[model samples]
Target: MSKLDEKVGKYIDAVKDTCGLEPDVDLLRKVTAACGPVIYQRDAETVASSDPDEMDRVKKNFLMKKLGLSESDKLDEGIEAAIETYGRSERTKYRAVFYYLLTKHFGKDAVYGS
Candidate 1:
């Protein structure tokens, strides 16, 4: 399996263990599928940009918009936390989904590795 698959699998297992319930694989798949195109687009954008600052901006924008939090006052804070935890890479899609699931199951503190 690919590294991404391994990481995601481990994350799923951890979530299941923490929650004392099996994760909904269908839900995880759906989230991953929905986020894939956005991740690909961000990859393309990253390749097209030589400026690190511009790349960061593009990544943050993509995360906020794709996650449907564009109008949120805490958008920047959320994006910052995500970027810090996940980095600006295609794998971020999986990380975002993992964070979403973690927050849903265990709350925000769990998401930040608390």
Candidate 2:
């Protein structure tokens, strides 16, 4: 498997185990497509920001805008909420897990404290 596919595959399994999420291939494709633009902005912010703190705003804006969520203090909350919309979940705030998947897909330099 390609690196991205391998990572997302693990995420699919993780979500299923964590919260009974069962995403189909079509939805996964759409999400992977959306990740392109979001990751681009993330990389840009990483490169542009002298202050590591400022990049959080860029990350939040890209993630929320791509996922069609309202602005929030927490991008991960927005992402988790968006995920819940796709499938109901009893558990909340799986952001850490989600970020782990993203980091695996995109690599540590891009998604994890870049």
Candidate 3:
């Protein structure tokens, strides 16, 4: 398999193992693809949920800008739920998986398109 495919596989496993959610493989692949070369970088590959700036970026960039969500408490709640679902003890929270959870959380799979 290609490198990206391998990463997607790892992401699929992470979602299944971490959150116990049956991941949508196609959407996860798309989300991983959307993550681009960042997935290859060690530091940038995972999200640092403890960082205020990182959380802000997730809210503004991913949720608000990419998903076109309004700035509201619901956005924070969705993010928190995804983080909680992913496990607060888990250190390496893959960006694609996290985004996928958020997308699923908000019923914004349509944002990814069919």
Candidate 4:
């Protein structure tokens, strides 16, 4: 399996364990689609960047610090905290929303990768 697949699989497992629900990639994709642009625009504005690569780097740093994710951090806690802080409790699940911001932070190819 590709590294992206591995990461997704690990996160799927983490979500199942933490949230007691299965993660649907399709649903997650929809969530990403709905949220990605706005999140990127805002984050980019925060760092005053228009370049994708620069935005990605800055957003990555911001997310890690904001979400309290260290180098060894797993998806579960970070995602949960994000939902608590930034999500709509009625419609949000950490697993479904995180990939969008992550994609913005790593570039458009982040999900499937280059």
TM-score of each model, paired residue for residue: 0.35, 0.39, 0.97, 0.30
1 or 4: which has the higher TM-score? 1
Score residue 71 of candidate 4 by CA lDDT.
55
Q: Which stretches of candidate 3 lie over 4 Å from their true place?
A: none
- 37, model 4: CA deviation in Å? 17
Clashes of each: 0, 0, 0, 0
For model 1 the local lDDT of residue 46 reads 22
Residue 84 in candidate 4, Cα distance off native in Å? 3.9
lDDT for 79 in candidate 2 is: 39
Candidate 1: tens digits of C-alpha lDDT, residues 29-103? 444444444434445312223355744554455434444334543544554454443334433234435445423
User: By TM-score, how accurate is candidate 2?
Assistant: 0.39
Model 2: lDDT to the true structure: 0.43
Q: Tell me the lDDT of model 3 at 11.
A: 97
Candidate 1, TM-score vs. the true structure? 0.35
Q: Candidate 4: RMSD over Cα atoms?
A: 14.3
What Cα-based lDDT does every candidate model obtain? 0.44, 0.43, 0.93, 0.42
Query: What is the model-wide C-alpha lDDT for candidate 3?
Result: 0.93
Q: What does candidate 2's lDDT look like per residue over 20-91, in tens digits?
A: 556444444444544554433434312222334533553555444433434555554443444454344433
The CA lDDT at 77 in model 4 is: 43
TM-score: which is higher, 2 or 4?
A: 2
